[model samples]
Target: MKTLNSYLSETVINMKPSGIRKFFDLAANMEGVISLGVGEPDFVTPWNVREACILSLEQGFTSYTANAGLYELREKISEYLFKRFDLQYDPAEEIIVTVGASQAIDIAFRSIINSGDEVLIIEPCFVSYAPLVTLAGGKPVSVSTFGEEEFKVNPEILEKYITSKTKAIMICTPNNPTGTVLSKKELEAVAQIAKRYDLLVVADEIYAELCYEDEYVSMPSIEGMKERTILISGFSKGFAMTGWRLGYIAADRVFARAMLKVHQYSIMCAPTMAQYAALEALENDEDVLYMRKSYQRRRNYIVQSLNEAGLFCHMPGGAFYAFPSIKSTGLSSEEFAERLLLEEKVAVVPGNVFGQSGEGYIRCSYASSMEQLQEAMKRIKRFVQSL
Candidate 1:
């Protein structure tokens, strides 16, 4: 009998499962588990946003939209970008509404990469980046970032990794699993390198709204970058609409055209009701502000608790994750996370799942409720003390 696995695409088979989701799946069904593993907002979609989707259905706006998405939603996205980040994008030609930020990223890779071409990925990064690059027929090259540098990309180290085959670089700000937000100065350094090398940038700014201390800057805001950067963002993180599956990509006409071709044939359009809901999300900022405040509070508490517990954790500038080093405990990230879950019923993702550089650390999301976070921290403190 032929093995069914033999017929699957080798590329798909070779890809690693997401480290964040692996721990999360275990945590989900466990009784009395305090999960700080999944990177999702604890808040539900705001009433008005949900009502808008309901209204759309009531009005019979259920047909597939234009391949790029509803023009109104695209216009709202355009306005939101310009208003928030000072970015200028053409709604008609540049933006494509996607199923989610995940899909937006996947299709962007499909748009620009060819077989054997390399795309530089910053680490520790979202687990999806490497596998998607490979699926798009591009090689995934990692440029390491360290905790000492606050995990910001160092231009010198990045330069050493670039080669003749490098075609693009993928970056996530308010980065997943590590709440590091690149500053304007940091981004400028990266922009200079990309400009000099003429590398296309795939900027995943899905967590843009969650930036703390400093305002988020779009990579395309940099000089000479607008034409070469494909910006991927979505309402999932900021608007707490993960199940809504609404995201979009903004790029130059040349790049947008290529992505549109793939999206057109592969995914005809984003959901009609979700598009209506997204418009409501865009027009209002109150729900976003409320959630950001909650996350910021949790972030501070988690970082302080981790450090006080004798785990070395740095304060993150954005997002809601607290990555603490467990190196002093003399345990690998996976071992520590597994033990913590079983012993304390507290769930955190092992950082090594993000990349090799993350091996000594674990990622703890602060997106849970204050009470849950407080309880998790208490359990973690006891667990560390036991070691």
Candidate 2:
């Protein structure tokens, strides 16, 4: 008899496990490990949001919703987008709530990507983008941004990666790992390129609410980009509702319909109770703002501490992460991360897992409590000094 692994799809069999989760698993088994590995918020979901879900359950509103998700939740998402980012979409026709932004991303690629088509992905991006593209039977082409550029995507360099096979460009901001938020001008430039190439733009703005610098620029708000841009976001990061697993996609009707078809077959609809919880989250911006402020403070302290310890970290403009260069310690990214965890009981993700361009750094999420962050920093400082 052949091995069970032989029966697995070649695509699934060959895919590498997530690099972020490796450290997370390592830290999980070890006691006294101050882990900054995962990007989840240390904050709990706000009381009112949880209360709304509990209320829904008590009311016995636990049946399946529309395949496109609750219309009211879609409307609230539409309103929130317009109110916060000046982006507009039709609640009934242009949005589909899915099981977190991860699902939104999956369906978006599956709907548009044909076998052998290419999607231009900016690195160091979330690990899922490339794999999802591959699973969709599309090639994920890397358009790497450097630290010297503050990890901001450059349109000229982006255009260099385009070819007849190229079908779409996927971008995230405020970005994961790097925390670099693109300016409106930068987005406009990429918009022009997308329009010129007649390519789709899958904009992952999951961390939009956490932006700390100049105004957050929604890609769909860019002129002529809305029709081509598929906006993926959720309550996971900014709303402190990671476990709620509620996210939505906003796109033109043509794209929305196609993606809805894929989502209906795969997920049916997002969780019914989570929709109620997300509705409450949308109504309560104050809680999200409070969390953002706390993350910003943590960001400031972590960046400062990393620089002081001679790790040469850039001050991230958004998100709750610090990508500090570990090159000075004369260790590879994985070596640095493993040694830091083993020797100092501090856990962080190595940058090389994100992409080749990330080889010299490590990503430290500052979403933990201030006390935890302070202690982690002290341990990190001592480790670096010893190096």
Candidate 3:
């Protein structure tokens, strides 16, 4: 009569559930709750992408693709990368379509991390980074970025966290939670460190298409970085295909070959129809432009509204989230978020869930409709005033 729990993997057991989903689930069960918790886009998948999937199904192309994915899709990805980001990768040797960017990230970790290896994770970052590193038998060392610096990674600070055990560094730009996009100068600072230390970089560029200001800088495009950088991205954020679960990874063939073995065993291939849909998504940039413009408008309104409401939000440069300081209210992030939800019927994620640097802040996604965002702003102002 031994407990079944005794046989469980301690790694999985100790991992906390996603903080984003925690608020999302709570909001789901409540009535009339306006959730700004999740980072999903409000836009529907473009008609062309959806039609491609339908066409694929109609044509009975429903079999498993190569473990690496369809050759045509991989080729299109290579062209899209070069065209959009000035990145170059060999389609046959360096690209692997994944179930999602989440999977792309996981396999990248597994491919490079060894037991007791340390991967420096820049924070406040996506919640999955640390856990995936740990699950891959590596240590996740967090390098904190603060609001004072607008959350951009400072190379001096980043280098301090490295050690003999450090194997790689994980970065998400146009970062989640905090919408700071790293400029080329900022990236070059980091690139210098990586080269000096000979460290690998896992760059999560899922929000590349959503950058608000200047052109997006791809890590691989940094001088001398393509050979050591693993580029992870997908259709989830910019293309509004989250449910389709399509993503891909591009790297030097040496790195890609290692990650492919991990993807091959765990995922086999990304969904057949989804691959076709993503192919269509890459063929056109008009839908992406339309959605990015909408998000930029929302970003402006939300940042302005939050600051006026006394929450002190910095204008995010990319991605659809606004991380505003709730320290003014003298409430812990969790306390503020919980009470705000209960009192005002508005839901947002507590920033501390992302990393310790995020404490005293909260993340509000501006991806909802204008009507909903306007109302959410009003309620948030009222809630702040009440305190």
lDDT of 2 at 240: 90
Worst 10 residues of 2 by lDDT: 284-293
**Candidate 3, number of clashes:** 0
Q: In what order do the candidates fall by lDDT, top score first?
A: 3, 2, 1
Clashing pairs in 1: none
TM-score, candidate 1, is 0.98
- The digit string of per-residue lDDT tens for model 2 on 1-387 reads 899989999999899999988899999999999989888999999999999999999999999999999999999999999999998899999999999999999999999999999999999989999999999999999999998888989788999999999999999999998999999899999999999999999999999999997888899999999999999999999999999898999999999999999999999999999999999999976888788888998899999999999999888989888999988899999999999999999999999999888999999999998999999999999999998
lDDT (C-alpha, whole model) for all candidates: 0.92, 0.94, 0.94
Worst 10-residue lDDT window for candidate 1 reads 15-24
Winner on lDDT between 1 and 2 is 2
Candidate 1 residue lDDT tens string, 112-196: 8889999999999999999999999999999899988888898899999999999998899988878899888888888998989
**Candidate 2 overall lDDT versus native:** 0.94
Q: TM-score of each candidate?
A: 0.98, 0.99, 0.99
Candidate 2, residue 241: how far the Cα is off, in Å: 0.5
